[model samples]
Target: MTPTRKRRLVAISMILFAVGVATTLTVFALQQNMTYLYTPSEILAGKVPADARFRIGGMVKDKSIERGQSLTVAFVVTDGDGDMRVEYEGILPDLFREKQSVIATGSMQGDRFVATEVLAKHDENYIPRDVAEAMGKAHQKHNVPEDAAKPSTY
Candidate 1:
């Protein structure tokens, strides 16, 4: 009702509006940059957006590593329930090998995953939580023994 009161109300309203806008923009930017990790089975089942970049985690299928021209390499990643073919044209990590856990960051190109970066499990004792859980679920679905379902068995 008073001029001073009106000015104070306007200032408060503008501050609130600016804060809301900043919060909304932060959320939008985070969503755009966020990458999800999926299992090979989930990807095979069409759980990922066709053109969205994401990470796939699984064990490198035994004997599936193939070297190609230049730095190109191809391999199959399996979570025991399903497999995905991955192609990468960069130098793979030193620990990258068959029968090891790997996380490939890329997008699907038709049936195959075209990876921009490939990460190998850092050591014998460490497996990514997502990969470990996916492997355990797959093994349990197949009625595997509890001991065999452990990520340490990798």
Candidate 2:
């Protein structure tokens, strides 16, 4: 109706539009870069996205490790109730071993987890906080073996 009122309305509208655009762009960027964590049980239940880059934390199943040419190694990451196979092409950590808690970062292919990086627990009786919590929950939910349920210092 009035010239001053019209100018003020236009200014407010432009400010709100800029704020909306900035918020949308920020959310899109974060979505693209986010890497989530998962457990073997979640993978088995088909809760994990197949194409998204994510991290898996669990114990290295006993007698489930295999060595291939060079530094390539394959192992089973288990969360008591379920097991997911992991393939890594780099040197494993010195602490890596069967029955140890580990976190692998990668994507899933078919039923196998193709890991780009693997991290094993550092100290005896000490599992990474997040890995320990997830494994403990999984162990509680299923009738997993006591040894498997316990996070060993692998």
Could you give candidate 2's per-residue lDDT for residues 118-139 as a string of tens digits? 9999877888988878777777
- Compute each candidate's TM-score over C-alphas: 0.87, 0.79
What's the TM for model 1?
0.87
Root-mean-square deviation of each candidate, in angstroms? 5.4, 6.7
Per-residue lDDT over 1-154 for candidate 1, one digit per residue giving the tens place of the 0 to 100 score? 9999999999999999999999999999999999898888888778898799999999999999999999999999999889999999999999999888999999999999999999999888888898898777766666768677687833
Q: What's the C-alpha lDDT at position 52 in model 1?
A: 96
lDDT by candidate, in order shown: 0.91, 0.91
Candidate 2 residue runs with Cα over 4 Å from true position: 1-5, 144-154
